[model samples]
Target: MATTNVALQPKRGRPSLARASAIDRVILERARDMFFADGFDAVAMEQVAAAVGISKGTLYARHASKEALFTAVTLDMIAQHSTEAARFDHLLTDDIEQRLRHHARMMVNSLVQPDVRSFQRALSTVQHRFPDLAASISEVGYRYMVRIMRDDIIAAAARDDIPVRDAEGVALMIVSAIGGYQLYETSTGKLTHEELQAHAERTIDIAMAARSSW
Candidate 1:
């Protein structure tokens, strides 16, 4: 009888767990780029698999569907933005007004980034399909800013640096005002660096003025 050649046989089922996890990351990254570059409806699973140099079967094994992959991508993006926002803590100062100004400018600068805008556009494009995701995203983003502002306000009040009756309400108001300004900028036109700086300062000034009434 001829000797069997085991090595020549086809190699596999799924990859090793470690390898599979790595491939999953690559797939998500490539899928994210595609989704950002070409809108959700325009990107197909086949396109993503091709971009990752994987077979459609393999891609589907990792992510059951295109919507599932997009969900993963959205969560990844949110985690990344959260990490970046966390770094802003180091930029804060002992001066409450200056701290608020820094936060305003940093937040606006982050929103103006091309990749961030692309992600926002992606979300808006698919809002109807992912209403709950959209709501969660909005809540998380809004809550983070409000938390930071509220903490700063409470700290300042503790030190008698400012007079505020309701820290939480004040925080909400400030965040909303800045959010409105951001919306205006997005709808009208991009602001220059100087203009953004001025905008940040003006927002801080209004907040400072209103603290007495808060």
Candidate 2:
């Protein structure tokens, strides 16, 4: 019997899969830009489809609704932030305090960027309408920062670098301090690079002093 050469057959779905993924990315990038440029309520699904050069049916097939698309864009932003954070890992020093100061400075720098500020303002406008999604986003972003600080505290405690009875509590306080500073900066003018460094150092010092007494 003659055998069919299965290995020579062309793949059926690979090209479509690749094309679909590329289209999805384009949709997200365009949608994010539109949403940021004009707040969420102003950006329609049809607009996103037109921006991506796709049919409204195609956009709806992928995202179902504008709310769902915005959620995806927000999640993508968080994922990008996490990836950017990972890139600074090699720059961390052995000392926990210095490591934390570096992290604080990094957060301040990232948070104050024009693009980040625009996205944040856009999210803030719709937060009341989408409270559940807002809560979820806050939890994910806040917990990620707390977890990083908690791990550092635990490691430093193990090495007797710092005395702390509650690593999680200390981490929360540290993160909260950074957040408070960020809020102040948003209300006031943007901090200079030197001012940002000083704030980070001061926040870390206060946390260290509190931990030492524990």
Candidate 3:
């Protein structure tokens, strides 16, 4: 009779996740700076923690590993770019060429960010060791760019502004052109900000001409 009085155990609920906030974002931004300045391989977890006035354990609690931190940075960069791209949607002009030019300008501006430049350089160095990092970066960076370009192409087609036999192919080519331009610039040397802007504008004009002609 006494054994029959045993109570049932309560079911466990899922653990709550920590959401990114202004304070957390500040910490992550500082971490990204350290990672960029020192390269991912050189920066240590303790360094990141010390930079943010936190302990190693605290940093680990926030981010599981250096790779995770890099992933967060990639995602953050993508989100920032997405927001910038969204603004163009509101101010989109009737001219398809104008839209293409705006997009090109955005792409050039994005690559010039000191942190972005560092991340890309670091990626090239450690891609062999951390293949996943490269893949993740590509997925979040290059792949995302391609998708956005594709959407823009589709939108232009919807408006009858650009004639495309294969919208996806055209979009891929557009992204490739931009990527090629960035790679070339990075390889040669750093161009002055104004020079880079001019180059992007010129490139966009040429690509758009080809697109329209096709």
Please provide TM-scores, in order, for all candidate models, with all chains considered together. 0.78, 0.83, 0.77
Would you list the clashing residue pairs of candidate 2?
A: none
Q: Candidate 2 — which residues are off by over 4 angstroms? A: 1-15, 161-163
- Candidate 2 on 143-198: residue-level lDDT in tens? 77888888888888888665668889878887787777766776566756567567
Count of clashing pairs, candidate 2: 0
Best by the lDDT measure? 2
> Per-residue lDDT for 198 in model 1?
73
Q: What is the full ranking by lDDT, best candidate first?
A: 2, 1, 3
lDDT for residue 135 in candidate 1, whole number 0-100: 70
Whole-model lDDT, candidate 2? 0.77
The order of the candidates by TM-score, greatest first, is: 2, 1, 3
lDDT of 3 at 105: 70
Best by TM-score: 2
Q: What are the per-residue Cα lDDT tens digits for candidate 1 across 4-57?
A: 223322247846666666677777778888889889999999888777767899
Could you tell me how far off, in angstroms, the CA of residue 151 lies in candidate 1 after the best superposition? 2.5
lDDT of each candidate versus the true structure: 0.75, 0.77, 0.69
State the displacement of the C-alpha of residue 67, model 1, in Å, after optimal TM-score superposition. Answer: 3.2
Worst 10 residues of 2 by lDDT: 1-10
